[model samples]
Target: MLKQLSVAVLTAAGLLLPAAADASPARFLDQSTIPDLQRAMDRRQLTSEQLTRGYLRRIEELNPRLHAVVQTNPDALAAAKESDTRRRTHSSRSPLEGIPVLLKENTDTADRQTTTAGSTAMLGSRPAKDAFLVQRLRSAGAVVLGKANLSEWSNFRSTAQIPGWSGVAGQTRNPYALDRSPCGSSSGSAVAAAAGLATVAIGTETDGSIVCPAAATSTVGVKTSLGVVSRGGVVPITAQHDTPGPIARNVTDAALTLSVLAGADPADPASAAATFPKDLRLDRNALRGKRIGVWRKGHTGIDQQSDRIFESTVHTLRSLGATVVDGADVEDISWSVKPDLLPALLTEFKHDLNAYLAATPGDHPRNLSELIAYNDQHRDVEMPLFDQNLFVEANATDGNLNDQAYRRHRAAATGIAQRSIDDVLASNGLDAIVTLSGLPASPLDRPGDPRFLSSTRNTSVAGYPNITVPAGFAGPLPVGISFLGTKYHDAQLLSFAYAYEQATHARQAPRYLPAATG
Candidate 1:
């Protein structure tokens, strides 16, 4: 079993100060999202450099305890200076000009920072280029503040892998409860946003990596339809499923980021069909007269507290003039827990990862086999918590995209996932479907049982759009409600989520409690 670090060990690297900050910037920066920060810059109340330094200081003072951020960009202040210059010259690049953002470590940056995906194996080497979305953010004048810690190898390393554990950066703790799991592979991205380390963050998901953690940490996560954002520079799980999206404190901020991050790229053919909406402004009345499918069957027995919040959310939707249709499920899509999904993921992981390694300019392991061997050689550091059995399985798979079985399973997965949502929407004539994001953060002391239900599975498998907005509290922890829609419905999903968010105003800034106690 993986050993849990003691409170002393957890706080050894830094002071365990209360999450409340008394710093001058905390008043202006603590709970500020993108628009709030932008307005502060526009009013000349804050400079890009000042804002960047405030976040850097927060990361330095607090990251030791939470381990939410892995490293700060050495030239972050310099980037912010450039943004200040642009703003002074009346030549701002985009709406995101001068805003700070933290990216999940899996995203590459051609700078002093290394993109290791929380693994030491890829350390000491810089990527030859920035990820496609990173380039977009830089072009929009966003300061690349730092990299956030995540589950090593995006939580695909071990079948028993813990959500926030990483060899490179021990573990990322929930801002709400330091001892709880930050439920996604994009743990750091969620934590960083919730802790006010950045105005926004970017996270990639093959499935629950984005929304799950966003839910657990009380932040907004958008899992754009596959190819809505390019997967070119991200480490892969499967080309069919991997896509990068934004995580922020609100739907408008997430939507704004998506507008900047989405577009076609030559490197990823899937983006050819991608389309983006120009207007991201949220209409608070967007839910009016909307027919919403409430999928309550999945989350009933797992957590009563979350279920109560879900029921309350359904009531809120009805009060907002939505016609809530109960009992909507994708019974046709049985791939969620089936054995066939693993083979498809394994086959694609080997093929896509090999291509990525070959293209990256480094002396790192060139493929899955070499990576597995690297882990075996460095067992003390790499395999202390859990072994790389998932890597082993992927390495053993016949890495052929053209193989008949591979093609069949991959096609079947996509088709089934798509049809599942399409049929539900068509039959019920629903605008969007709602469900609990997942269970609140689990305890990190041991290998916990798998969650019985998750809203991410159906939409993830179908390559459709999904958005998570903080619903309410499950006791001391946060819970989120998800909105799922058919493929290419990202804009509508965002609009709907935005409406609910504006009405409820449920998200709360984390208290950074030491641990739960009676």
Candidate 2:
């Protein structure tokens, strides 16, 4: 199955070139952050068109092996030329000017590329307008490089589906180790960012989608407080927990990207009630005199190497002038029980997805029921590996957000999650809670992989901000530590993450090894 998938992806990418032609021209792009690229452009040492073409060339050379990018923007060079013109006129829009960014396939761009969420069912579903976040990136003079492949329907399609597999694009391989999972459903975004396919990428997360992939690929992922970044035209998984955030090679790039994306949108009601921080500048001394709480409940005793690395991280934090509080776990919440989350997601997925399909101008399934039928009809293409049981369950729901049972379940889940994080913070008098973002990537194509462990659910359910940075490596695989903060505290969390990232500098460019190394 893996071999076949690899061939299919290579064929789909049209990467059957000679050995000489396969050599990448953008080796300098490796581990390059947005600020570094901006400075080069500012010094007239580089043009946006040059940077954009370099990335495009890299994607053409490497994407066949990693399957990170599913589509390349036809107008990307033109947009870069426009950015170059603006710079020539001394009218740069923002720090992101002339930077190339990859958008997760689920993000709507209203361009030549299709926003299919990596599913064949929505193959032609081109949204009428760009997602609010995409509009923000464009207005900031960022070039839309392409759409990165993702787990089909952002991993909401089935319970037994593979993490990075999709009907539209085959599996996305981890750049660090091709045989290991890239994690999902933001798999391609993180893989691309880690491999320098782009300067930065935007990924949406309902739960661990963004952070898990980022952690697995040794990149920085910021899952903003739900309303901090608008989800206006992005494909939905439940508006209550869905958000589009940045996945970059470093914390500063993620924070800078978030500043551009954070704004209220009248189209999304959730954004209206949220207050975005105006100043997103990070202070290297942000951790000094700050109380940081360590939540090691699920992180410890799992992997000895990870535990040792985390202990070192805690020591580093204390040495950097932080007051580290041990045993500040969110004891009120039970990780074993999630009675309301599934049903609530099913109800909300049905309701929200229907609305998104109806609003999108395209010839595709218009609702959950139609989507299920479409999958059923095209079983060979859509469900060859796993059945769409989640879609069937969602379709069974009444698709009403106003249903009493759904509303009650949603409220209970959100309340418990909020209290879990909030109570711990308040009782400990800490600025943020830190834990392992996720375990290292398991082997790809293993359906019931037990090595996966997630620590993003509480923050995801509470609709708060969470940022994950590379803490260390286990063998050739990367481990990330997450800093979770209360709602609307996105800026503060980024500052803390930035400070930690600068001190440790743990992230490394991927080597694209065939397997993990000791």
Candidate 3:
């Protein structure tokens, strides 16, 4: 009875705000999309400052409970004012002119906000400038609302670490059920988007960081093809695997955000040889006559709840004119048999991170060893839940790229992953592969016991493109279906995902409920 009363009280307090209030035509900012907001602004029914203030109000009301937003941009309103000025002058930059977007804490912005990756050791560390992607987002007129909390050090601190619990910001709860985990290292970004705290958010992925969190939170996540999005100012995990991508509540929004974020960067040599799409649009009939491979090889350990959604998704695609092939397996891919991923990441992390630190303008720890030492010195705060074993391991390793063993492992893994994906696509004449992105959010008490199979390994290792769209729910929690394609096939992948999303509008706004009753 007390629990029921508590829930009623919370709901009455406007925790589960509606999409539209019957008393006024002012649509809920949480329910408004980038284009929708722009239309409202153009119609004179809304202004950039008004929209920004609405979002800020929502953040102030819910952030304390969700812990999704680590900080709110103090200048968000001012930036929105500038956007309003641009609109008055007919000098709007892009479609994102007044849209507010949240960024993962690891993404460096040369503003007052700190880019700490949710670690105390790098709390006050400031970069001289915004990350290459941030520069593009700003140029396109998207306001950097603030940094979202992430798994400390992008979940690389320890093998037993919690996904969303950062040393600096604590744990970000699942907005749908506050007790459930918001998977990371993109936890806060996923939660923020799911809760409608931002128009869209950016999350960086070395592996499952972007997709896993989006799936868990019922948001759309686009893990772009390696080199499609520049990683110039993003804190390092592994340059070979790390790429910043978009997380949003729908496929179109994610696609729109990606359009702004994707491009070549001379500073990021990995993207130097990459191709960016000249045009991207949603075609509802995109799945018509397209052959998509169902990657059964990657479906191990999928829970019954998610499998049910996956089956329904397959039927939905078939109904929409897609030829779905089940039991499609990749040939010559030995990801499970190989131990090359961690080794490669360790090598690159030690080298890439130190280089970034050396370039950063701050008095913080400048190397992995110093970072490790800082954590030890601040053990109660930083290492309360998990130790820095991964840091120690990376620090001890000789990670020189010139080393013969390092080169061998990197080449071998990259080659195996790439060949496996290419061979499967060619053999099946498949445009893309579909699989369960992840299962529902798990309870935070046992953070290590993840319930679903992650589709991150193959795509991350192969440096290919993958996108996740909400498929359905496991009770109150969400499950996502992933669409993956060959390298530089981001457009095709997005089209496929967008088509599925249109066919099955599975995403729903989070309710900020206290817990999952089921």
- lDDT by residue for model 1 over 1-518, one digit each (tens)? 00111231233332122346543234345445667667666766567887787677778777888999999999999999999998889898887999889999999999988899888888865688898889999998999999999999898888989888888998899988898888769999999988888889999998889999999999999999989999878988888888799999888789889998998889889888987786667799999999999887657577888889999999999989999998886553454536567788888888988888878887688878888889999999999878899899888988899999888887777777788788989999999999888877778875434545557777888889999999999878999999999889999999899999999999887878877542
Prediction RMSDs, each to the true structure = 6.2, 6.0, 5.0
Alpha carbon lDDT of residue 38, candidate 3? 81
The full ranking of all candidates by lDDT, starting with the best, is 2, 1, 3
lDDT of the candidates, in the order given: 0.84, 0.86, 0.83
Model 2 C-alpha lDDT versus the unseen true structure: 0.86
Q: Give per-residue lDDT, candidate 1, residue 406.
A: 85
Better of 1 and 3 by TM-score: 1
lDDT of 3 by residue, 1-518 (tens): 22332342244432233323231212244445678768766765567776676667777777898899998888888998899899988888988898889999999988888988898888769899999999999999888898899999899889888989998899999987898989889999999898878889999998889999999899989898899999999998898999899999888788888999988899988888888675788889999999988875546445777778888998998998989987676553444527876787788889989898889988799889889889899999998888988988888888798898888889888888887788878888898888888667878887534433457877888899889999998888988888988999988888888888888888777767789986
TM-score of each: 0.94, 0.93, 0.93
Query: Clash pairs of candidate 1?
Result: none
